[model samples]
Every structure is written in C-alpha cells, then in structure tokens.
Target: MTKKIVVLGVSGSGKSLIGKNIADKLDYPFFDGDDFHCQANVDKMRQGTPLTDEDRKDWLATLNTILTDNPTAVIACSGLKPEYRAMLRKGLDDITMIYLKGTIDTIWQRHQKRDGHYFNGREMLESQFATLVEPEKDEALVIDISQDASAVLNEALSLLSKK
Candidate 1:
C-alpha cells in the first residue's frame, strides 16, 4: 500500500521527529515542510517575526504539491489552520492526517531545546497556538506528544494499524 502521511502540529510538537519515525517504520520517504520555505519566510522567522498567512500561501501550496506529487511519503508541517490543512488535502483523499497534540508548557520546553534552527522565535509558539485549529476526531489520528519520542511513535504506529 502506498501511504501518504502528514504529521501536523504547532512548532515543537514533535511533528518532524515522529514523522521521520513513521516514515522509517513504513520504509517511506520523509519530508519537512520547513525545508521548502522561501528565503523571505525564513528571514521573517529568523528575525522573530511571525509569518502571516500571506507569507505562508506559497509555502503551503508547495507542500500540497509535494504530497500530491510523491508516491509514498511522510511529511511534517505546522498545519495550524483549517485552510492550510484543506490546501494540503485539496485533491488527495488517501493522505493520513496525524495531529501531534500537547500543551503550551510541554511544547515550550521542547522548543527551547532546539539548536541552530531558523524557527527560533520562542514567542511565536503562542501565535502558532492561537492560529491552530485542531483537527476533529473524524479528520485525523490525534496523538499526545507529552511523552518521549519513542512512546509517541509507538502510540501513533499502534493507532495507525487500526486506521
């Protein structure tokens, strides 16, 4: 089975970490939406400026294309809003949506540990949370990311088998 998976959450929710694990487990390719951001958007984030919807428009479209273009892969993206998720699913019905859920305090702690990443705007995490619209139960497999990465990966893989 060719699987197209997207692990979504706000910054520092461990989407990328777990996305990579999921891809490895399934022997599928892994992509980080962050890697596809335009230089301008990267600059904005690097300057502690939150990217507006305008800044994200092209990047989101690119990610959408990547998912649609790939045969089988797992992607990690900060799919904060419903519109963003919709764009990602615009014409694809088989995409597996996984939402990494955690609290502000939990994710904040993890976010602070990150090193040499462009998304260094610690204050932006709050903005990401404010913009986030969590997927409903019917739309995605929601995984709690307050635990260790291995535990979270096991939980997601376990739920995925039943999905």
Candidate 2:
C-alpha cells in the first residue's frame, strides 16, 4: 500500500522542514500546504491577518485533491483543528499523521527566526493554538520539536518503520 503522510502542526512548528526531510528519506514527493493557498489567502496572512475557516475551504479542498492524486506523498499542513484534519482525511485511508508538538515559546522563537514566510507575526500563533485540537495518541506519532532536527527525524523514521 502507498503511504500517505501529513506533517501537521501550528505555524513555525517546523511542519515544512520536517515533512521535507521525511519525504526525502522515504523517497516520496513533498508538498507544502501553504503553497496550495490562494493568492488572497496569502495576501491576508502576509498582512498579519489570521484566516477564518471560510477563507480556507478552497485551500483545504486543494490539499485533499493533492493527497488523492498522490497516494504516496508527504505534505506539510497546519491541520490545527479537528475539522480541518477531518477535511483532509475525507477520502483517504492508511494516512500517517505526524504532529510536531511544541510549546508556544519554542514555536514563537522559530517564527521570529523565519524569513520571507507569509505567516508574518507571532500574533496569529495564539489563534492557531486556540483552534488546535491535538491529535489523540492513537491517531498520530507525536514528535517533540524541542529536540534537534536530526533526532526528531530519526525518531520519526524509527516509529514509521514499525507501522
């Protein structure tokens, strides 16, 4: 069976970085969900405005289509809410959801260091956390982002191997 992986987390939680690493390791195509966003959504986020659920409908549908098209792909997405995650999982089965778990301070520091990203400021992070419904232990392999990238990637690889 083809493996479908979604590296999900709040903004600046290293979803893109970690997802890319996993995709390279697994030899699967990698996609950043941010890239699927419409120009209007990108503009709003670039202006430091948080997107509402309505603004994300088309973007989520696009990501879902990507998953449907490439069954063996790795995607980085801010699947913060349970509804959002559910939307992504609409048609797929056997998906591995990897949650990059981190504290607000840790992610905030990463956000501060990020350059040229549409997610402009730390102000939106709060809203992200507020909307987040953390994946249950049974539903995801939760990796602590406090660890170095290599260690986290190693752990993910090891855990995924067992599945």
Candidate 3:
C-alpha cells in the first residue's frame, strides 16, 4: 500500500532531491516542506536568523494538516526535533520518516555551495544541529548523505516496498 513518507534531515542533506525522485518513482505527490514556511520565517532564514520553536509551530501544524489530508504523499521536511516529528505523526499512521543523516561539516559544505538557498550556512548549521533529536529507537531509515542519491533512494525504496 502507499504510505506517507517524510524525508527528514538538516539543511543540504539532499532531502528534496531524493524525496522528489522517490515520490516520482512511487507516483505520489511530492511536497517540499520548505514551501510551507511563512514569509516571516523565510525572511528570517534569508537574514541568517534561526527560527525558534514558536516560529515553527504554525508551520508544522499546517504540514500536519496537509499530510493527514493527503493520506499517502511524500514530504521533504527538516523534522529535526523529536517533538516536531511527533507533531507530524499526530493523527497519522502509516507514516515513515526517512532520515538523511550526515555530519554538520558535510551539511555545511553542501549548504555553502548552494548559491540561491535562503539558509545561511554558518548560522543555521548550529541551530539545525541543536534542534536535532535523532530518530527514536530506529524509527526511521537512516541513510548516510555521503552515499549516492540513487543508492540511497534504492535503499529507501527497498525498505518502503517491504512495508
């Protein structure tokens, strides 16, 4: 059966690229969670400001609604915090979080090379790391970001197909 999949990670972990590819392969709607951010949040990130949990609450709520409503779509989201992941899980079952795990250095390197992205590499790196609570009790498919995107997607798709 089709299932809701949240591709979770810090910035520059290639969640969007991989998630979109997986969604296309699976014939599911792909939603970039970044698109759900409000203008204020976008402005803050563009200005190198880190978002407080308060700043993200409403956005997360909206994501929850979208995911719940869609039932089985793919979402690329930085579900960095445990509580945030829990919030996403609320009122939803058959949801799987695929964590694209990587070191801060790797993430920063990727972010720095990103020419037109909103997030400031130096500033948000720390915040993203700080907010991160690694997937609980292996409740996710933790793929290394250093791997090839095709390989990573293959692994994820293999696992998801099993479920």
Candidate 3 lDDT tens digits, 59-132: 99988998999957999999898889989889987888899999988888788778888887576888888889
All candidates' lDDT scores? 0.89, 0.89, 0.88
Of 1 and 2, the candidate ranking higher by lDDT? 2
Superposition error at 142 for model 2 (Å): 0.8
Write down the TM-score of every candidate.
Answer: 0.96, 0.96, 0.95
The C-alpha local distance difference test score for the whole of candidate 3 amounts to: 0.88
The model with the greater TM-score, 1 or 3, is 1
Question: RMSD per prediction, one decimal?
Answer: 1.1, 1.1, 1.2
The C-alpha stretches of model 1 lying farther than 4 A from their native spots are none
What is the RMSD, in Å, between candidate 3 and the native fold over all Cα? 1.2
Candidate order, lDDT descending: 2, 1, 3
Over 9-117, each residue of candidate 1 has an lDDT whose tens digit, in order, gives 9989998899999999999899999999999999988888899998998998999899889888899999888898898888998888899999999999987889998
On TM-score, who's better, 2 or 3?
2
Worst 10 residues of 3 by lDDT: 136-145
Q: In candidate 2, what are the lDDT values of residues 1-163, reduced to their tens digit?
A: 2399899999998899989999999999999999999999999988888999999888988988899998599999998888888889889987888999999999998888888888877778888888889999887889999999899899888888988
